[model samples]
Structures are given as C-alpha cells and as structure tokens.
Target: MCTYATVQTTLEGSAKGPEGSWFAVTDATVYFDHPVHALAEHTLNIDFADPAKGPGARVAVELTAAAARDLLSAIQEALDSAPAELTA
Candidate 1:
C-alpha cells in the first residue's frame, strides 16, 4: 500500500543531476510511494531540486525501506562523528 506520505524542506546543498553535471539543490521532497523506475513496488523517494533552475535541475533517489533506514543511520553517524564546530 502506498503511504502517500510526503514531506518537503528547504535546504542548501548541491546535487549532481543529468550528464554528470552539478546544480545547487535548494529543496528536498521526500515521500514514500510507488517508484517510477525502481523495481520495488514501493520505495522511499527523495527528490533534491533547484526549482528556480527549472525541472531539469534535480536529482531523485528511490530506496527500499531497509536501504532508507540504513541511509538514515549512516547520515546520523557521519554527522555525529564530525567535529561539533563543523557540523554546527
């Protein structure tokens, strides 16, 4: 079943999009739903985008639940291991 649960946030970062090019990512849209390309019936989808640059300036990721949880743990670990001054 599709959760249809979505969340959006403004972020300051860069993500590599099409053609091995990089773009400023200003927003993140995260959702759990059917994936457009992933073989999984449903996935945790994340779209990093720079809306001002148009639709092409975006990077999308779809991960299985287990993978998503692992990613979350990895992110927390990386952040936690960083110097407080740098992370802050």
Candidate 2:
C-alpha cells in the first residue's frame, strides 16, 4: 500500500475519464509560476474524488497563467483541513 504521506492534499471534485465518478486522492502537484519567475511559484494541487470509493470524480484543472496560481493557493485551505487517517 502507498503511504498517505506522499499526498500533500486531497481534491474533492469531479474527475472525468477511465475511473468515471470515483474519488481520486492524489499526491502533491508541485510546479513553478513562470519561466521568468521560474521557482518563484511553489504550489501543490492535491485533491480527491470523494471521501471514499464513491462518485464525484468528474473534474479537471483548467486554468491559465496566474489563474493556476490562484487555484493552487485556494486548494491549500482544503489541504490544511484534510485528515491524515482513513475514514470508515
């Protein structure tokens, strides 16, 4: 089993394709802002389809430039509030 530590956050949105409406708890998504700024933007986009093996996995990350930064920053709040344990 993969350690939960790898996942810095969990996105509770809709994930389309393959898995259909399933929860997707993924690892951290690290990236920079721009070529000029380069490493100036260090953010991670963590998310999950659902709390369990249910529906709601039908989402995608569609952003542009600075918008990406905003979306990532916004997800930070969810990360800070996610639990480190599996729920029953």
Error of 1 at 15 (Å): 0.6
In order, candidate lDDTs are 0.95, 0.42
lDDT of 2 by residue, 6-66 (tens): 3335443344434453334543232322222234333222333343443443232324447
Worst 10 residues of 2 by lDDT: 28-37
lDDT of 1 at 73: 100
Estimate TM-scores for all models.
Answer: 0.94, 0.30
Instruction: Candidate 1: count the clashes.
Output: 0
Which runs in model 2 stand beyond 4 Å of their true positions? 1-14, 18-61, 84-88
The alpha-carbon deviation from the true structure for residue 17 of candidate 1, after best TM-score superposition, in angstroms, is 0.7
